[model samples]
Target: MMIIKEPKELQQELKRRRFEAAKQGRELTVGLVPTMGYLHEGHASLIRKARANDVVVLSIFVNPIQFGPNEDLDRYPRDAARDLALAEKECVDIVFMPEVQHMYPQPTKTKIQVEGLTSSLCGASRPGHFDGVTTVVAKLFHITKPDFAYFGMKDAQQVAVLSQMVADLNMDVQLVPCPIVRESDGMALSSRNVYLNEEQRSQALVLSASLKEAYELVQEQKSTTAAELKKLLTERIEAKPLAEIDYVEVLTFPELEPISEQTRLSDYEGDIIAALAVKFGSTRLIDNMLFQKKDVALHV
Candidate 1:
């Protein structure tokens, strides 16, 4: 595996081989797994998914533009050395760990919006967060031009938005969605897990617990109604002292147009994604679960 610090260095390195490969009439199948630096088991899960296919290229750049002024950018957990060591262990082909300046030059103006999908949930809280995410991911897609891209379902909205942009704009890469990785305690693993205090940490369980409650309720065929499910999860999380519910929305997968009411199995079509974002003290964490209606679809 190679560590590329500069964008030009990465582009320069890719150019030589891309040309050579293009000349031979061979289409290179590459997979890109994008992440912020603080590598955890959840991140490893993404790497494992990418490595299972063709050449896996991971980009580790903790985007500042994505962070709100009040959000934790400076305090955000990052260890490139730690991340690189972990990536090497996973046999990642190339680790594109670029600096901030290398990613975005002075006073960036333009942003990418996938429309409709990003305005709710995490977007409701972190305004322009998805724009930054989409912009960067789109840039990455253009830079690497991978055959497919991998992202954890933990950031369901971002995935949906990016997927939409790709579909709408007809981008050439396939979006490979992966399942959410969790800790034994049911907390969905995130890089921000490091910020949790002893007390705040315990309160964070309410987020997943509420989701679990929804899952269990729906599984029992008791209350699959969206309002009932949303309310059920919302009240439980609000009961926690440290937790503040940013948005407990249940939506249709791929499109993310908040489905406030889901009853019959037919109503919740294709893959269903349940996503939630909560704040513990000043830090925010997001997690989601992907429910497939085909094989593992819940029924009594």
Candidate 2:
């Protein structure tokens, strides 16, 4: 994989990638996967599939504008050399690791906003997080103008928000959402996995287990209300000594508006999504599952 560090050099590389493909009279499908510097298996899975099907353009930019006042921008782990090494193994054709200043100019003010869905899930706790994410991803998309962009399903609400943003903005790219990569235990894999101490690691299972219970509740045909299910999740998540429940709520999919009424699968086109956010130690984690009313009705 070629590492393009300079902005002008990267643009020249992109033009070369475009011209080389055009010479063969073949449509070059470039799949763009955006990430912060530190890379992991979860990110590799996205790139692997992108490489199998298209020219993979992986970007590593630890965006600062996205970080809030008290957030972990200063402390977020970063290792560019390690990230580039992994990108090569993943069959990524081009890795664009831009400096923080290259990604943002002084006196920049514009931002990208995804309505409704961003207001809930992790959005509720981290103010302006999605705005930063959407804006940076938007800038990358414009610069590379890839045929497809990929993301992991572990960030369920982010997938929903980006899907909405692309449709709304009429951007000419397919946003591919891949499944989440999990630990042998049920905990979802994340960059923040580094923060968990031995005890905190064991306690973190409660978050996933609580979501499991919520699904079980829906399975038992117990009166399935979003509120009671969320309550069950909150209680289980907070059982850990250092864990704190940020928000655990059942939301209707796509719109992601919090569900208040008794929602039936038939009513929602089989697109209801359960999402939650929790803080363990100083790290915040989010996870969700997409389900249909049919899945609830068929519970064994």
- Local distance difference test, each candidate: 0.79, 0.79
Candidate 2: lDDT of 250?
Answer: 76
Q: Kindly report which residue pairs in candidate 2 clash with one another.
A: none
Supply the TM-score for candidate 1: 0.91
Q: State residue 40's C-alpha deviation in candidate 2, in Å.
A: 1.5
Superposed by TM-score, candidate 1 places the C-alpha of residue 281 at a distance from the truth, in angstroms, of 1.0
Over 1-300, each residue of candidate 2 has an lDDT whose tens digit, in order, gives 788766677777777877898899967778899888688888998898787555788999888878899998988888888898899888888898888677775646898898788988788788899998888888888888888898988787888888898999999989988877777677888888787788888888886677677777766764576666666777787777788878777777767876665664334554677777778788888777666655532111
Clashes of 2: 0
Model 1 poorest ten-residue lDDT run? 291-300
Clashing pairs in 1: none
Query: RMSD, each candidate, Å?
Result: 2.6, 2.7
What lDDT score is found at residue 30 in candidate 1?
80
Clashes of 1: 0
